[model samples]
Target: MADTIDEKTGTGRTEQIRDTSSSDRDFRLEEIDLNSNRDAKIKNPLAGIPHDALMRNVEDFAREREMTDLTDLLKKGAQIAQRPSEFETIEGLTDREREVLRDEVLHRWRQPKALYFTVILCSIGAAVQGWDQTGSNGANLSFPQEFGIPDTEFLDAAKTIPNPNFTHNLWLVGLINGAPYLASALLGCWISDPLNNFFGRRGVIFFSGIFCLLSVIGSGLSQNWWELFITRILLGIGMGSKASTIPIYAAENVPASIRGGLVMCWQLWTAFGIFLGFSANLAVQDVGRITWRLQLGSAFIPAIPLVIGIYYCPESPRWYMKKGMYRKAYNSYIRLRNDPVLAARDLYYVHAQLIEESHIIGKSSYLVRFVELFTIPRVRRATLASFTVMLAQQMCGINIIAFYSSSVFVQAGSSPRTALLASWGFGLVNFVFAFPAVWTIDTFGRRALLLFTFPNMAWTLLACGLCFYIPEDSKAHLGMIALFIFLFAAFYSPGEGPVPFTYSAEVFPLSHREVGMSWAVATCLFWAFVLSLTWPRMVAAMTPTGAFGFYAGLNVTALVMIFFWVPETKQRTLEELDYIFAVPTAKHMRYQANVAFPYFVQKYIVRNKNAKLEPLYQMDKNLAEGQARSASISEKP
Candidate 1:
């Protein structure tokens, strides 16, 4: 039995009992000398190191890798067991020293002081989106009066002469509410790809910040609807580019473990900006003619931090690699990561993936590549994933609350002052709920959160619609409606709010990331344009109950799409994701999930099937089998 255990372990016995059985001594299995049997499965490279010291190294490696699972532990252990030449660290050190040093540096890389600050800085672009949402929400309350809008029933009363321009007035309001979104969709979707390719992520952010700054100022100073509309168009262009650029920038810089949380900071800042925008609205609500103007212009404040802070940040190392600037990519990698060894390893994977992508695409024009995005199965899966997630986000009706919460409150029978205050409550709820997503995103995974929260959102929207059936002044009605609206925010914030952006950032390879994300964000802007242009008209025509009921139905569709189409992206390295997306599983998952439970399909259905038909899976299986057979023959000999 002892010889068999030793043989199975692929190690020789070094510590043996000397005739202890004759002396009535008990036999015990002693701890293996990890250093002696270098190829043994349970060997520890840092065997002689203090337990605390070894643990510290482990902790450091965990942080760099963003280690959240036992798989990470096993992988790291197997990696550490490799011989000196097999390691990615500096060549001179012994295997044990190299392992410990590699881990120490990885810890440093994970918590890099400058890189995190850079990520936060880039995320300010999202603050602009939030600021714009609430600013417009508040501004809409007062801007109508200044523009001769027939806001009250008195304008059509028998005693008063009817306004001839009421139709024109409503058109202008739709224009004002929707122009930025339209421009953002058109320009942001199309223009971001070229700008990102030509100038890089940091340059696009800086340019967008400037556009936001000038446009907000122009919006504030406008004397007529046209002036404000044109400025908003410019603002939309800036936001369009920024929205597409920031997430890519952050994802390219961080480790896969923390990448979801870090990229979600975009949503976090956006929530913060929403809270500030609402507060700004409340602060200037009594300023007479300038109240709406102040709200519109207050967005400029967040842009300053974005512009100043972006200058200090490094461009994505992947971007540098794509452009054939290897030295620059290496330097950026070093600056972004904790140690040169990890940097080298990460860069190696990035280069390999980029090369593979290039080989698959061959030498194609930008137009050809863009066209091929639809033609390639792997790339199309990513594109469709990004598009679907963005579509789901807009269809959920979260933006309806963000863009017109104040108006919804008024429609619910609250006074204008009460409506603005209630909007603030919505803003606070949005901000608070977003924090939990930062933790849950990387921990529980993306698909799980969407599956869990989307149903709550759909039901809550229905409840909100039901509230409109009650008498307007009743406390029960108002309280129930407000509770439902807040509940909708609670559900939307953690799931739809961050997932779309983070998921879009994840699905695309570096070669297509910029254009892919741009299109995804464009899809968001397009739907936002639809909702902004139609919501008021929908409410006026169908009543708030019918309008919200429509939104609830859309949420149901979104839930179906998410359950069927979206794959779990948590814990995967960006390069590794290339392989996963290449598999023809998304369509199969969608079909199976539509037929049954998605969780069961993911856990049991997919794993249980033999994948040996696929060439890659077949090759891997054959190679593994061959190795096992060879090992058995050697053992027999």
Candidate 2:
């Protein structure tokens, strides 16, 4: 039998025993050095030892095997096994780090290059959202007049409606716009997983862009209201897919440090697109209703770039790893990182960690996965957080401003043309102020902004609502209301407008993120439908003042929820967030870590000190130990 050798030193030793008689076999063993280091070699004897003798020897050895040591060995073995997988993860990275040496590789990605591409691509999708949303706004304004209905006939038809008021109309319009959003939200949830599964994220995006273009054209060419509504529904489906998939694509592809910044670009582009649409409307206001068709039709320009530009974009490395296509994933990683070896190493690390933390949840059926979101506490919290944020977003009455600004201004005593121009100003303010949100979402964090701005928004709306209650012939009161309206838009664009979208994308884990965001967005759509359907009636009943006040109250409720529940997620890495929220105790504790919390409470909150700080520190330590172990193992051969 071959004798086992000690691995640390390539040395051999022999064990000898005396024979009692000639009949007794002579027991002699000589150690031979093996070319590799394996624990199994150290574990077994040359010949089978009796159970009693093995037990005796173990008792005499004095040192028992430790669970921690066993754990470390298992972890080390896993690290070694995954060394080849590191290459697969690099495809998810941006261009700046592609040139770095393996030894010098760091987790912080090169920002401008990777983030710039992410911003640019995601911006394309967001522009589509803005154009589609605002296109409808501009189209509706002209549709009433261009259809050749008398003003009295239009108002009479509107009055005959079940909810015959400004609030009811506002709510109804919200519902109409939200109908497509609802479909998009729900479809976005299911389509994201499979679309990503078969064609990859880039492919899904390319297809969605095509759909958006077609929908826009369909909307522009519609000769009737019903045709326009159907096209809008189609456009909603496209928007839903884009809304769900694009954020996941951007979030997964960027480095942890700048992920927030890149995702915020989606909002920035949305605002810019709305502004552009409004600008187009203002420029062509006197050029006849055909200009509205042109404005609505022009969304095709950006859709073309989105489809073509996405063709060159790489698939998410994480998705590639999940599918077990390691080699292809590796090649993609290399292309993305511009370094094969380093790509392999990072891919291996991510794969090993994924395997270690693997759960059965992700492999389940779609309905099962969807159900699990509500059943599991952490997932439930995440889902609710997303939903609540989106609900708050819609309830803030911003959509009423977007869809009914002309109506609201006319009620405020402005002429029809002046009201339309003021509506354009609202879009312009939305565009200009959105930049501050994009700039501060990462810096100020989600909860901070929410807490700070929501109350002000509520007050602004309340003041505007009160202004409506003022008697007519008060131009001074009207001036005050107009100033407050401008302030309302300014506050909303920088705060509520961007945060809902950003928060929905950030709070959920990657495994269920798409579905979670889909549901949240869907919730927005549902409420939008309710608000739109009822807004006209509410406005008719209470006029503009009472309608604005009702929404202001809802904003206050949203503020209370945000102050107590929302978390600060500005700089957390995906992995760190995963581990931080995995534990039941940690999950609830983290919800209170927002920067706006009291200092003493922030420090002393249960598990806040340990739970919040420990995972990130441990992640770093584990990653370091894993790298060291890999180096030791790789050095042997």
Candidate 3:
């Protein structure tokens, strides 16, 4: 379609075809999308222009924008963006610019102070979200009783007594505990589209933080379960909006090389906040009637820093560009990048890609763009991929543990004290294990980690449930149950924990990102709402063993969904991903099942050292590699 680049020269070339049929157009589009990465050879719309002509165009572009002072810098920047790795030959290159450019690749993690501050702000928002969740976990033990709505009472290890109004109490308690997620799914997440449209990313986060503060205060002061429910309903709005916005905000600002790790800070710090929430739960579990109040209210602490610090952070430069504030976007980029030259390169490069993106997903009414998330082919693929990851997150049953691990431990013959301790142990394991993913995610890539860990999670959860069959009289019973759950958390924290949000945030084109993310987060939180709402009743009826075993089975199903639908996005920039998502789901599925599986079986299962596994979409060091792959696949029996 637009243009193609030579891998060695980074110069554009065009090929003529007599066919103008829609099928041919579609074929060319696939070529651009599927050839996304060939050892850094990608379609560049700006390629093949002569240096003099490109510089002249840059001069005119700057003059029109009242940026003539930056004309020299802009010329060099444009040249570099066209041929990123071959900047050494670009004319008018100063030693300082050259050194900075080199440093960008060598020290990608070495970023501007403002960029890190932005990440911290986003992370704080995530912590607020995580903390809000744990408050209810600990508060659940005591709040219902205080409100004259105790759901149950245990007389012995295996025998539990339901309250006379147990059915009503169970629904109310679940409703109260699950209020935030419910509000998030139904209202808060969807509103993010409009909020982001009007208030910008920072504004949505700021307002959400304010909501979180109000809800936490109201929950602590509520005198009844219904009052607590209403208050948490308010908290859900904040949680939904904040959850939708934070990952997108973080992903937009970070470099692609380490994007997985940086964007995943949302989950890592959320786990830390979960740790803090559980810590608060432990600290106040013995405070008599006030324990639950303190647990519920302490969640407000993380929100305070989030609201205050977000103002100091720069808005996403891409957002600035979308809003047509070019000068302001460039200024934001200056503070974000380590050097002005790098800033210039990114600004122009992103702008060029955005132009191409606009052709694919044009500016339309909000409703049209929202509809495009499913109706447009490329955007629809992103929606499906994002939906798969988000749905898989819920199906993996992490939220079951997150929302009701304390209850689960209590049901397994643990005393109130032992349950809180075990919940704390799970929290600690969740937080501690998440640290390794920060490095490993970027290294191993998101898809590999998910595939490797899901089976492990499924088995561990099954083992945990089976351990419930071990007689309570056996000293090994409780200890064995805790061990398996901790192991499950270990697998979950790295794989599914960090992936869904980070993956969803970066998949959609900027035009539809707000709405696309709204859909993705809604899917996640809505399912979370269902899980939280139903689990107490489900566990009560089915018993912990059956309920846990049910979800363990779900883990395997999620793994399969992930294998076919989710694609690897490691080290690819936000715009380059346009092509990645453009790939049809059916095609991607075929590649995974028919090609990737057989190759994996040959290499890993059969231990055939000489086995050659042709990559699915990737082109190796040369052009013939991709051709050979296509020919090999076609010849496959």
Candidate 4:
């Protein structure tokens, strides 16, 4: 023990002789100097040294005294060096190991069954989004009869007379219906960030669920279109909140490996919800005027599950980290993961990555941050691509098809009931094909699918337009239009429908994720508003052929833009993508490709030689280190 003390004190140096063998293994000497300000050159007695350095010295002494092998010394040194700070390096974990750690952490928070149940619960919000959007489609089918409104003939006559009163009422109905979405978009921009900060993801979701419940009830009990419009506005507010927060919540909670799949569930349920709304509306179409009310009111049912189940769902560990609640974040990670050791490791890695990334992109005012989005060339390209894709999705005549399907059918010589049922069939087809999107999105990659589907959609729309040119007396022509509509919906399910959201969410950096997504959605809504407002007029002018032809033309334009611009984003992680596009060469390629494809590809492909793949390599290293640290910590006891 005397010789041990002498050696540990370093070469004949005398230090305080304290025996703490009786206490816990974690015992430490109070007088040992490990402060950062300690003199570096000091060799005097009681010279302050870092705890790490002292541990190394002690371990070295032990090795010399015991004639230990290098492996044994390293193992002993690791045990002695195990401190809070030593767990920071986790970038060395293997993919399988990281996944194991991720799973372990998730299991710690909740049972596997409960985790899956959370997915189902959160999907309610998704369903509500779908139902709300399409519910009006079916309602429009019966709205003219129920309200004693002029049918298309009377409305056309009313339009010709051009009485200011009749024109005002027409505009009023559009306002009442359109006003909510406008308000919701504005509110979404203002409320989402602050609400996320104030109420937490779960809280905001719960509050939105309450709003949905009330809106559905109010819409159900509406005495007039004006009253229903007010309810729709309220519902729109809820939808806006859902749009901003649901993806954030889902992204934050899910492990990276399964995140895309889990988030896609939101889209899946949304399609299902549309199907349900359309089917329900069809079932009650002949029942009475109240059928539309029942259809609109049924949106409330899903909110119950959201409100109840959200309470059990944990707040995002990422959000907790953002709040600097490291311990709380770790605990949440544990809940999400179900393993303390793995949770600790993941929590540290997540913290490090977030902090490092945030530091690189300096914290700035919201306006500055927004400006930065366009200032960075790569980010700009991504932003524009996102905006264009969403714009194309809305402008491609899907909404027109949805909102005026019954009217279209009437022109094609189908009764209102048959037309409404056909609309329901469209929704059902959309729902069925949505599953393929989930399976293929990650497997086949985004660019390939977009490239394939856009042309098909264009051709289908062209065929439908030609069908409209066929004489109204021909049943075969009408049959072709119906078949084409089904094909259009199916093609859309795997293409524009799910891919826009997926791409928008993927291309932005972590810091700009929420803002980018919000902007994309805002763009979608803005175009949707334009299309919705103009669609009735366009359909009336072109008599379906001109409108479908115009949309088909837009589809062709979208195909050209997508073929040159969008990159394959399937299977790649966000971090990996960030690194790939961070270089000057990649950045140039990204923008130039958007404008001129072949030249951009040639130049960028050559420059790809200079593209450094270090970030991905570093990320893999960090993950491995994290897993090893987790394993070490788990084995400590």
A best-first ranking of the candidates according to their lDDT comes to 3, 1, 4, 2
Clashes of 1: 1
Ranking by TM-score: 3, 1, 4, 2
lDDT of 1 by residue, 186-298 (tens): 88657888887778889999989999888998898889878888999999999889998898899998877578989888888888889889999988999898999999999
lDDT by residue for model 2 (1-637), tens: 1121233463543222111122111221322111111111221111223323322322322122122322322232223223222422423333433334332324234433543665698898888777776665655556645543212222233234433343434444445545566567556445766676567778888878988999888877878656766777777777777877787777766644456667777877888777777666666667776866775677776788898888766677766655544455555655555344445444544542343223323344567668967886556666766777888988788887765666666667666577667878888888888888765876687767887788888898889888865665777666777777878888887778888777777667655666776777777766765665566556766657678989999999998777655555676545444443443434334434543344435566643663333222222333344446435544654
Q: Which ten residues in a row have the lowest lDDT in candidate 4?
A: 37-46
Deviation from native of the Cα of residue 53 in model 4, angstroms = 12
Q: Supply the global lDDT for candidate 4.
A: 0.61
lDDT of 3 at 136: 86
Model 3 Cα lDDT, one tens digit per residue, 468-544: 89998888899999999999999999999999999999998888888999999999999999998888777777777
- lDDT score, candidate 4, position 181: 63
**lDDT of all the models against the reference?**
0.71, 0.60, 0.81, 0.61
Worst 10 residues of 3 by lDDT: 16-25
Off-target runs (Cα >4 Å) in candidate 4 are 1-111, 144-151, 154-177, 338-342, 365-372, 376-382, 580-637
Any runs in candidate 2 off by more than 4 Å, and if so which? 1-115, 145-176, 186-189, 330-346, 360-362, 469-479, 583-637
lDDT at residue 269 of model 4 (Cα atoms): 85
Candidates 3 and 4: which is better by lDDT? 3
RMSD of each predicted structure: 15.1, 14.2, 7.7, 13.1
In the predicted model 1, the residue pairs found to clash are: 109-338
